[model samples]
Target: MNQDLIQTFIEETEENLQVVEESLLDLEQAPADQELIDLVFRAMHSIKGGAGLVGFEEIGELAHYLENILEEIRQAANPKLPDDIFNLLFAGIDLIRQMIEDNDLTAKSVGRELTELKKAIKHYQLVTQEGSSDEQTIQQQTGQKYYKINLKFRETIFETGTDPLMLVLELEEVGTILASYLNREQVDDLFHLNPHLLLMNWTIFLESEQSLDKIEDIFIFVKEDNQIVIEEISEELEQWFSGGEETEKLLRKEEFISNVDLDQVLAKQEQIGESLFLQSKTTKEETGQADKQVRNLHKQKRTETIRVATDKLEGILNDIAELLIAQSRVKELATGIVGLDRSLQSEIVNSFQEVDKLIRRVQEEVMSASMIPIGDTFTRLKRMVRDIAAEKEKDVKLVISGEDTELDRKIIEQLADPLKHLVRNAVDHGVERPEQREKLGKPPTGTIELDAYHQEGSIIIEIVDDGRGIDKEAVLAKAKEKGMIEQESQLDDSEIYNLLFKPGFSTAQEVTDISGRGVGLDVVMSNIKDIRGNVEVFSEKNQGTKIKIKLPLTLAIIDGMIVRVGGERVVIPLNSIVEFIDASKQQIKQVEGKGLIVSIREQYIPCMALNELLQLEGSFNNLKEEPTGVLIILKDDQKQIAVQIDEVIGQEQVVIKNVKENMGQAEGIAGATILGDGNVALILDVPTLFKLAKRLKVG
Candidate 1:
C-alpha cells in the first residue's frame, strides 16, 4: 500500500519485463537454449512475485499464467514453440505493459484483451497436455521425488519488504507438501517481541516431479541470506515405508511418527547432517573469502553509478553555464585593470586558465551522466519490426549494430518516434514480400539493419534495408501529380530522393494501413529538424534504401565558430564548416542562372553574403565591397554552400539556450548562446541556411 513500495515495484517490474521481451526474441531463434528459457522464466517469475507484493492481482494472475506456459515449454522434449504461442506470449507482454501503465487495480481498460489472452493460454495448456499425456504419465511414474527443505530466514527479512511466506507459497506451487513443521524456537516472548521481525522457520517435506535444480530455483530469491538446506528423502522414505506394517499405518494416519525408533534411518539422517555440516563449513570458508571480494566489487559499482533526476541534472548544467559566463566576465575585467603588478596579472591569468580547464572537465562529466546507450531503443525497434513483419506477412529480419553507442538521454527519448516511423516505412514500403524477393533471385527473408555510430562530432543513425529500393521515377511522378514540383524541373538522383520528405508526399500505388497515407516521411523530417538534426535518403533501384540521420551528441553545449556577420556575432557549428576562403583569392562571378558563384579550384559553389541573406545593418551589403570580408564554406551530406562574412572570430565552446519559447521559431537560427561579454549570439542551422540560399536564387 506504500507509494514508495509501489513505485519500486513498478520500476523493477518494468526492467524484468524488458528482460522477458528480449529473451523471448532470442528464444524464438534458438528455442533449445536452456539458458534463454531460464532467463525468460526467471524474469516472468520475478514480475509475478512483485505484482503480488504490490497488490496488483490482475498483473500477478497474467504473469502467473504466462509463467506456467514457460514452465511447460521448459519441460517439453521439443523446446521449439509454435508461432501462435510466441505471438500469445508477446501479446501477454503487451497487455501486462498496458496494465502497468494504466495502473488501474480494477483492470477496466484491458478487461476484454485480458480475458481473451487467458482463454488462449488455457487452450494452449489443454492442447499441449493432451499431446504430451503419455510423456506426463511416464514422468509421473518414474520421476517422483521427495525433498526435505529446511528454511531459516534472516530475522530482518521483513524490513526488506519481502514476506517469507511468499517463498513458501512459491514452493507450494512447484510441489505438494507431504508434511511441514513450524520451528518457533527463535520466537521471543510475545510481550517483548518486535512484531515486524520474522522469527519462524519452516521444515517441509515435499513430493514433486520436478528436477532438483528447479526446486532449488524456488528458493533463489531468498537463499542468499537464509539458511536453506534441501536433501533427497525419496529413497529413505520408500525404504522405511516398505520395512513394516507399522510404518504403512503411520503414513495412513497422516501424522508425524515422533515416538517411532527407526535407528538406522535416524543414524543416517544424523550422519548425513554431520557430513553436510563439515562440507558446508569448508565451503563457507571459501565463500567467505569470495563474498568479501564480491562485496568490494559491488561497493565500487554502487559508488560508480547513482540515479539522479533529469531536472536536477539540468539544474547542475544550468548553474555550471552561469559559472562559465561569470568566469569569462572576471577574466575580461582582469585584463582591463591598469597599473596592476605583472606577476599578479600573470598569476591571475593562469588561475583563470586552470578554472577553465576544471569547469570544462566537470561539464563533460555531467553531460556523460546524462547519456544512455541506444540499445534499449533498438530492442523496442526489434519488437516493432517483428510485429509489423508478421502483420504484413513479409519475411523480414532486423539486424542491429552499434547499439551500445551512447546518446544524450533527452535526444534519445525524442528520437524514438522518428526512428519508429522510418523503420516502419522501411518494412512497409522498402522491403518486398517473401515471394517477390524469391522471384527476384534474392533471399526470401529480407534484412533491415539499424546502425548507429559517432561520425565527426555528431551521432549518425542509419537504417538500411536490402529490399526493392526507392523508385525514383515513381517518386518524381508522384511529386508532379501532387503539384509538389514543376513538371519540367531538371533534377538529379539526390534531388529526386529529397522529394520523399515533401509534406503530403507518397509514391505508393495504393493506400494501406502501414503507410501510403502521405504522412510519414514528412513527419520524420519535421521531427528530426526540430532537434537541430537532418535526415537524408540514399537509394539505388532494386538495391534498397538507406536513411541516415545526423544529430548532435548533446543539445546543451557545443563547440562553435564565432564569426562577425554585419553588426551581429553569429555562432556556426564547427563541425559544419568545411573551410574559410579569402574573397580576393577566388574568382567571384555572377553567372546568369546561378546568381553569385565562387570558384574554388575547379568547382563553383553558390555564394551568399550573410549580411545580405539576414538583412543585417551596419556592414556592406555585398562581399566584394568589403575588402576584409571572408567566405566560410559549409557542407551537409547533400550539398555545400559558401557564406560571406566580415571576419572570423576565435572558436569557443558555448552553452546552448533555447530561445524558441520566447522568440518563436526563427528561420536559419537553431538556438542562441550567451557570449563572454554578455551578448547573445544566434547559432545557425546549416541545412536550413543552405535551403535559404537556394530559395534566395529563386526569388
Candidate 2:
C-alpha cells in the first residue's frame, strides 16, 4: 500500500473513531435517533472504504459487517436496538481499528472472526425477518470499489457562482442515476420556510467509457471547499443494493403494520370528506396541505467529517520548517563570497524570495488543517457533568453553546483533560446540593455552561457554573492554614481567587476521586501557560464561578523582540514586553535584596537584568559608573523584569522550534528559530524566567 494513502486512512479513521465515541455516548440516550446511528454506521463505512483502498482487506470486511447491522437499525423506524448490539458494534469498531493498526498481522489473525461476524448478522436477520426486520442484509462485497459522495456545503460555496445543483445535474449526464434519494424533506411551509438550501443525494451508477478522472473533473472546482467524496465502493454493489429487495418486498405487505411502508398508511393518516365529522373542506386545498406537511420532513443529512492527521500535517510543517531553515542556509552561503559573484547572489536572493513565498503558502494551509471546532472538547463534558450531578443526587444541567467556534487542534486536544477536570470540580465542589440550594432560595438544578468564541486572534473558552460561589474568607483561611499566605496579607479579590490554583491546595473539606487531588488546577494553569495562554478565575460569594482561558490562534510563527545576550542572539515574545528604557546606575535601586527598581519617568519599575539571572559568560552586569547594556522592560502581574542586553536587536516574526528534551527546558530559552542570517535565535521564556528570578531573589 502507498504510504500517503495509508497515512490519510489513519488520519480519517481516527476522526471517525472520535465521532463514533461521541455518537456511542449519544446512542445510550436515543438509540433510535437515525442521525446518531448513521454517524456510527458511516464511521465503519469509511473505515471499510479506506481500508480496502489501502489493501487492508480483512479489516475492511469486518467494518463492512459492522456497518450492515447499524445500517439496518438506521433505516428503520423505532429500531429494536439493544445496548448489546452497540456493544458488539463498539467491539467491531475496536477490532477493525486493531486490525488496521496491526497492518503486519503479527499476532493472532481476526480473519476467521470477521467471517463469523458476517455470517452471524446475516443468519440473524434472515431468522428474524418474519415479524420485524431492520434490513435484508446488504450483500456488499469487500472487493468492489465505488464512489459514495455527499455534498451539503456552507453558503459561501454558492457565492462562488457555482450551482451545486447544476453540478449534480451534470453528473447525471455522465453516469446512470443509481440509488438517487432527494431529502426534499426540509422543504417546508412556503410562507415561512427556506428554499435556497438544496437537500438531496443522487448516487450515480457511473459506467462511463471516460475514466474516473473525467467523473472527478466535474467536481474539481468546488471539491476542496465542499463535502465531496470520490471513492471506490465494492465490485459487487448491485448484489449489495439488491440484497435488501427481499426485505423490502417482505415489508411491502406483511411487515407494513407500523412503518414507512404500511398498507393504507397514507389512508389511515389521510382525513377525507370534511373529516366526516368537521366540515367538507377536503379538496385541492387538502392535497396541498398534505404536500406541505411532508415537505418539512427533510432532516439534515450528515457527511463524515474529516481532517488531515496532525502528525501528517506536522510532518509537512516540519518540512516547511526545514525548508525555511534551508532557505536561510542558502542566503547565508550567498553572502559576499570571495569569488565576488554579485549577479549570482542577486539570482540566488530572487530564488530564495520565491521559495519563501511558496513555503509560507504551504505552511498556512498546514496550519489551517490543524484547526478544529472547540465544541468537541465541550461536548465530552456534558456526560461528565450529568454523571456527577446524578451521583451527588443534584440536578445540574450542562448548557453548551458556541461549539462551532474553532481553535487550533493542538489547543483543543490539550484542553480536553483540563476542561474535564475543571467541569468535574465545578460540579463536585462548586454546585450546591439540592437541599442546600432550596434553603438558599436557589433553583435545585444548577447550570454548568461551556462556551467558546473567537476574538481578536485568540480562542476564548469559558466554563461557568451557577453554584454556591467560592467564599473568599474560606479560601483565605485555607490558604493561611497551608502557610500559603501571611497573617495580614492584603490581597485583592482576583489574587485571593487565584490562590486556588496553588500547588497542593484545595478548599474541598474532604477528598474524593474527583477534585481533591489538588493537582488539577495547577496542571491546568501550567499547560495553558505553556501554550502561551492565560487562565483567569472569576467568582462571587453566591452567584457562580467561571474560568476563562484565552489561547492564541497559532503557535507556528510569532513576532518576537530580539536581543543579544552573551553575544548569542535571543528572541523574547513580543506580547510580554511592557516597555524598554535606558537607565543610569544611580537610577537603579535594589529592593529586599531581590530585584532592582529604577524610577524611570517617575514610577518605580522592578527589573531583573538578563545577564545577572542568565549568568551568561562575559561581564556586562558589573557596571560601576553608568548603565552599560540596554534595558528591555518585561513585566507580568508577579513583578517587573528588565533583561539588560548587549544590544537592542529589534523585532521580527520568528518561526519557533522547540528546545530538545535531552538538553531539558532551557533556562531562558522558550524555543529556537532561524533568523534571516540562518543563525538560530533562542526565544526567551520571559514569564517563567521572570517568575523564577523573583523566587530566586526572594529565596
Candidate 3:
C-alpha cells in the first residue's frame, strides 16, 4: 500500500520482464548453453529480490522456484529445456508488465500462472537433478545455510533521513559476518540524487551463542521503527557449525595477542612506505606523472551508481543558455559604444567566442551522457530470436553489428517495441524453415542480420532475413481483394509491397496462432512513424527481405524555422523544410479548380495558408505583397505541400514540450517552445497539416 514501494515494484517488475524477454530469447537459441541458464537464473534471482521488497510473498515464492530451476539447469548443463517452460516464463513476464502498468495483472492471475509454472519447473528440475551429480552438488551447497537472518532496514529508515551506510557498518560489529550482498539493482539513473533509500538486504551467518532477541538488542536505539528480522535456518547453521569445528578446537580462553617486536615492525613498515613513495616521485619526475591511482578496495563501500536525470541537465543547459545570452548582450552594447578601444573590443570578442564554444561543448556532453548503447537492447533480443526461430522450425541466427551505437535513453525505450516487432516478424514470417531451405539448395540455417549504424544524423536499424522474399504479386492480389488498392491503380512493385502496411492487410494462406492476422506490420509502421522514422522494405524473388527503419537521433530539441501566415506565426521543423523560395507572380498558377500551386524546378508545390489550418485570420488580397511572400516547401514522399507564410524568421534550436498527455487539445500543433523573447511558439504538425490541406482543397 506504500506508494514508494509500489513504484519500486513497478520498476523492478519492468526489469524482470526485460530479463524474461532476454532469457527466453537465449533459451530459444542455445537451449542447452550453460551461460543462458545463468542468464535466466539471474533474472529470476532479481525478481525474487524485488518481490520480497514489496511484501509480495506469492510472487517471491514463485520467483524462488524459477531461480531454482535456472540454477539447476546451469549446474547440470541441462541441454534439453522444455518449450512449455519458456512459454510460461514469457506469460509470467507479460503478466508482470500488465500488473505494473495498469495494476490489473491481478494476484489471482499471477498466482495461477506462477503456480502452473512452478509445478512444471519443479517436475523438470526433479527429473534433471535425479540423474545429474553436478546438480546435486549445487543443491547441497545452496541448501547448507540453515539460519537465514534477513535484517531489512525499516522503510522509514531512509526517509526519516537515517544514514543507511552507518546502520550496515554498525551491524558488522555485532558478529563475524560470513557474507553480504547489496541489492543495487533498483538504482536507476536519476538526477538530484538523494541517497535516502535503503536498497541493501543482509544475509549473514553470524558466529554467536545468542538468542534472536539478544541479536536484535544491537538495534535498540532505533529498533522501535527499524526492521530486525531473524530466522533460524537450522540446516544451514549445522553446516556452518560443522565447517568451523577445527577452529573451535584452536580457540583458547586467554587474552593473548600475537606480540611482535614494534621497533623492527615499524622499521619494515617505514622501509615499505619509503620505497613506494620513492618509486612514485622518481616515476613522476623522470617520466610524466605517476602512472598509478590510489586503489583501496577494502574501504570502497559498495554504493549504487547515480546518474543525473535529463530534466536536471536540461535546467543546467537552460542556465548556460541564459548566461550565453547575457554575454551576447554585453558584446552587442560594447560594439555600440561611442569611444570603445579597438584592441579592448577585439579581446572581448575573442573571449566571448571562447566562452560560447566551451558552454556549447558542455551542453552537448551533458546531453550525450544520457545516451545508453543500443547493444544492451540487442543482447536481450538474442534470446527472443532463439525461441521464435525454434517454434517456427527455422534455423535462424541473429548476427548483430554496431551495438555500441548510443541513443537517448527515451529513444531507446521507444525503440524497443518496434525493434522487437520487426525481429519477430522476420523470424515468424521471413525466415524459412530448415527443411524447406535445404530443399532449395540453401544453407540449413538462415541468417537474420540485425545491423545498426549512424547515417545523416540518424540511426538505421535493419532486420534482413535470408529466406523467401516477399511475394509482390501475392501482396497486390491481397490488396485488391481487401479493396486497399483501386482496381485501376498504377502502383509499382515497391508500392504494392507497401500495401502490407495498410491496416488489416494479410496475405497468409494459412493462419497461425502467432501472427497471421497481420496486426504486426501495421503496428511496426505506425511506431516507426510515431518517432518520425521511416521503414522501407526490399525483397528479391528468391534472395530475402530487408526492412530498414531510420530514426532521428533525438527528439528533445530541434532546429525549426518560424514563419508567419495570416498574421500568425507557426514553427516548421528545419529538417522537414526541403526548400524555401519567393513565390513569383508569373511562376504561380492556379491548379485548375484546386488550390494554388507553384512550379519549382518542374515540381508542383501545393500551397496552404498557415492561418487557415489553425483557423487564425489573415489577409493576402494584394498579389504585390504576396509576390514577396515565402513558400516553405515540405516533402515526405506521401505529400509535397508548401505552407504560404508572410516571412521566414530563420532557424533556431527549439526544445520540444509535448502538450501533456490526456490533457488539452494539441490538434494542429506538434508541441510548443519559448522564443528568445520568451514568447510561446507553437510547433506546427506537418503531417497533420498536410493531410488537412488535401482535405480542404478537395472540399
Which candidate order results from sorting by lDDT in descending order?
Answer: 1, 2, 3
- Candidate 1 backbone clash number: 0
Better of 1 and 3 by lDDT: 1
TM-score of each: 0.83, 0.57, 0.59
Predicted candidate 1 versus true structure: per-residue lDDT over 1-699, tens digit per residue:
899888888888888889999888988889877667777887898888888887889999999999888877765555557787788899999998887788865578889989999999998778766775543211232355677787888889987778878878877887887656565656689788999888776767777766665687777667667788887666566432333554445333432223243343344434433432211111111211222232123222224445477899888888888887787677667777623656577778688778879999999999988889999998888888888899999989999999999999888988999999999988998899999998889999999999999987889999999999988888888889888889998777867888988888887778988788888788787778778887778898788999889898998888899999878999999999999988766667777876788778888888878877766776564544443578898987647888888889888778788887887656688899888788999998887777677768811
Better by lDDT, candidate 3 or 2: 2
Model 1 quality (TM-score): 0.83
Q: Order the candidates by TM-score, highest first — what do you get?
A: 1, 3, 2
Cα deviation of 346 in candidate 1 (Å)? 2.0
Model 2 lowest lDDT segment of ten = 279-288
Clashes in each model (backbone N, CA, C under 3 Å)? 0, 10, 13
Instruction: Compute the lDDT of residue 2 as modeled in candidate 3.
Output: 79
Q: Which candidate gets the maximum lDDT versus the true structure?
A: 1
How close to the true structure is residue 279 of candidate 2, measured as C-alpha lDDT? 22
Best by TM-score, which number? 1
TM-score comparison, 2 vs 3, better candidate: 3
lDDT string, candidate 3, 316-435, tens digits: 756755664455456557666624566677677677678767866876786687678899788777877876776777788888898899887777888889888878877887878888
